[model samples]
Target: MNSPLPTAWLEIDLSAIQNNYRELCRISGAKVAAVVKANAYGHGLVEVAQAVLEAGGEWLAVARFEEAEQLRKNWIMAPVLVLGYTPPEQVVEAAKENIRLTLFDTQTAIRYSAQTSQRGMTVKVHIKVNTGMNRLGIAPQDAVEFTRWVSGLPGIEVEGVFTHFARADEPAADTTDRQIRIFDEVLASLRSVGIQPKLFHASNSAAVFNYPQAAYDMVRCGIALYGLHPSPETLLPATFRPALTLKTRLTSIRELDAGEGVGYNYRYYTSKKERIGTIAIGYADGFRRVMGNKVLVNGVEVPVVGSVCMDQCMISLDGIQGVQVGDEVVLIGKSGGLQRTVEDVAKEWGTVNYEVVCGMADRLTRRFIHSNDKKG
Candidate 1:
């Protein structure tokens, strides 16, 4: 293991992650598929995957074939489903590794079928039906025929059928209900033709909490498993605990004169004599430059002063008395009565929690801390 770095680091609570997984399963009343794509939303893929399995998750889903390959190489033998496209050239190797691929087109399914036939092995695939999300998957109108074509292919095993919700997190349900109706129509068409995949899943994190009916056979828990609601508009039970805590120590503290400016371009000037705390983290560490003026510190919400540097940022400490050098600065996490969640930070960046967490870079060390471990 590498020694801990002295600069900013992320603390991931493994037990909290497990708790979130179990709670999602309990709420949805369905098998849970731990979505570990984007390195488990930057919480460390292998670590989070292991924790999900320990929490009784039935499957693991990733967005890339490389991620599935990496999991296999690391001896993660649990079922891994790639939720996105995989090149036809890699189909045979993917099958050999026992990684499940999402199939949405007949051409790609034929390629995979041919590869599996050559190897004398069956490749398991999940049929992705596009109910409403226009980003991927075959259109719902074509899903029944596509499923039939794929199921009859030489070596293709239709082990699952799935779809994605476009706006399950929204309070309004017209669009989501329409998508579900279309998906159900496709499923009924397939069953009428005597084709039924063993697994049927359509619920993402948002659907898991809000639209339990979409949790067909397994619920894919991505953001929710990390203890973040899909959107701030969502209100889930309080059992979900956020597992990632981003922190940096105060590298330097200085008292500034009333007219003195801080950081690049003099964007911030002290209205009066003020204490400024410089933290050892900045945009390079996935702390977005847009977050320069909004963040949390020492259990008090504080404004970041001036421009954010590549490696550091300054925060005004005028209202926070007695904060000294080497104090732990929380960018995202609870400190005493103050909690800065990823959703709050995302609002500052005008994005979502998924982007906020996935944007976290790898240069900073990740310190995995168990909930049961007492801090020294």
Candidate 2:
């Protein structure tokens, strides 16, 4: 419709995303709040958020105030929660848009309350507890007093409480269980003092699958909603379908002599006479330089020769036949009967799947394919 965007682009299946969200709902058995931060982990924020809302997501959670602002600007009427800090100045504007803020400290809550009360409005806040992750959150010991204080502050509504798990993705890690115990103790303390928040969510994607008991009033899912398992080591009864596919057209093909080298500094030299192909995608497109030796082409693993360029990379297509200059090359996704999952790329790059997907650059065109369209 738009003169066909770039050949190196991303295909997002909205249906698959919906399915993943629904699957998480079933797994958590609690209200699901779709975590749509980092541009929905590079799956296009607006589209992903729309799909989640269409699929019964109780609310949408983003990692920043600006993300929530963008969602509102797009006319997303569903409840929006900012999971991270919102500077003191942005509090009033955020409240005006009905965005909920996460409160990790009493002073911040007091400051926010002061702003909201002045405008004759109240702001909803979710209390963050530092069970063990210790990244961001008030200590569990001070949570009761902290929450109690914030709950009484003018224009502050303590609506929810949540914690993050540091080792939930590790299949054998008991650290997640320990975090849950700490969170439960905090919750019990809160309730004992009549400070029970309406919402209690502690399970992220990993915890949702691994610890059902941690699913309190809600579960926040990020990667799992994008159809990639939280960790490759995760064990689950149901499979999650990946929703994003990275594709590019083969731009060049040539034969290389045994002594020839490829790319800058000759990072890769031909072991023998070989066929090499250039793809119109590279680090500039979010295909990291480190990904040079770790990509795939149509189910067949190929060596990324030489240094990855800003806009292109070379791969050895030595033995593959029936190849052409315009053939489709899959960097991440299924091809024929073989597949290269996001997890595969993540492991190869020595990073997490979240980085692999979120690292997808915005320059790559995004094409949406519906679940129904797939069958027809």
Candidate 3:
């Protein structure tokens, strides 16, 4: 039996992901930990992680324990570092599965130590230092002392020390330099006291390019892994290719008279007699209502008219020739000579590319496409 074709689907290029990983490796000249959190920025977690490993990525990074557990469940045994909080209840389980966790506070460390000790297992942890991003991690001034204290706790092996860059994406910001200096000082202090973790990393995707000096032992590659630039100021080389393409099929077409209202609340009305096409995709499928103004139909740019519905949106097919039902509509990807990149879509939504890609809904099917295996 064959499954019905999805009305809308995302085509994920695994080869592009692999190529991006290789490019990041070449740029940083360091071990790359592919960041697969947020469902690989909504590209499909397990598939993306496997693609990274195939690209020679030695490590996998995620924001939660459940994500790491998911990888384990899928038999992805690569070294995984949970870059965010891990609940105390899951500490023992994490230890048992050998999932590394990011340690920032004393309470969590103590709890992890107690839990792992009870289970007769030792859990590897990375100490997160707050260089500039105050969102998480121990303060810079206290990083060394905290590292020493946490290293002394039983059942906890300090495997790494790292910091997150808040402004690395902003090339002109001197904050990244200052943060690097502070992190270096903390590393020096730790070394002076003979408390050095095995791995020390401080570079994210942006830092990997803008500030190569901060690529300590490894660089965490997140957005770049999905072929999206970290920011406007930091872009990957042209050799890197975007891995995801969003597409749908035009389901219906109708003729609208001049001044005819369209969609909910009549957000858009025809100024003249026009051909309107309805696409089988909308906000419920991760295509935001605010993101319907423009789409690609048969390589021709079309204006999405009116308020986008939950499951469908209308595009003005005026001036387009010989359009018919089931025509391919590209929301994000190349069509003919024109291409709509994720960055372009991000601009339309007034958000960063990270949010645009990561916000893709789970219900939308993801068809994995590999260069050697095009069957997907």
The TM-scores of all predictions, comma-separated, are 0.95, 0.94, 0.97
lDDT of 2 by residue, 179-219 (tens): 99999999999999988888999888888877888899898
Candidates 1 and 3 compared by lDDT, better number: 3
RMSD over all Cα atoms, model 2? 1.9
Instruction: Specify the highest-TM-score model's number.
Output: 3
Model 2 residue 139 CA deviation in Å: 1.4
**Steric clash pairs (candidate 1):** none
Count of clashes in candidate 1: 0
Per-residue lDDT, model 3, residue 176, is: 94
CA lDDT, every model vs. true structure: 0.87, 0.86, 0.91
Give model 3's TM-score versus the native structure: 0.97
Worst window of 10 by summed lDDT in candidate 3:
1-10
Question: Which of 2 and 3 is the better model by TM-score?
Answer: 3
C-alpha lDDT (0 to 100) for residue 1 of candidate 3:
15
Cα displacement (Å) at residue 65, model 3: 1.1
RMSD of each: 2.0, 1.9, 1.9
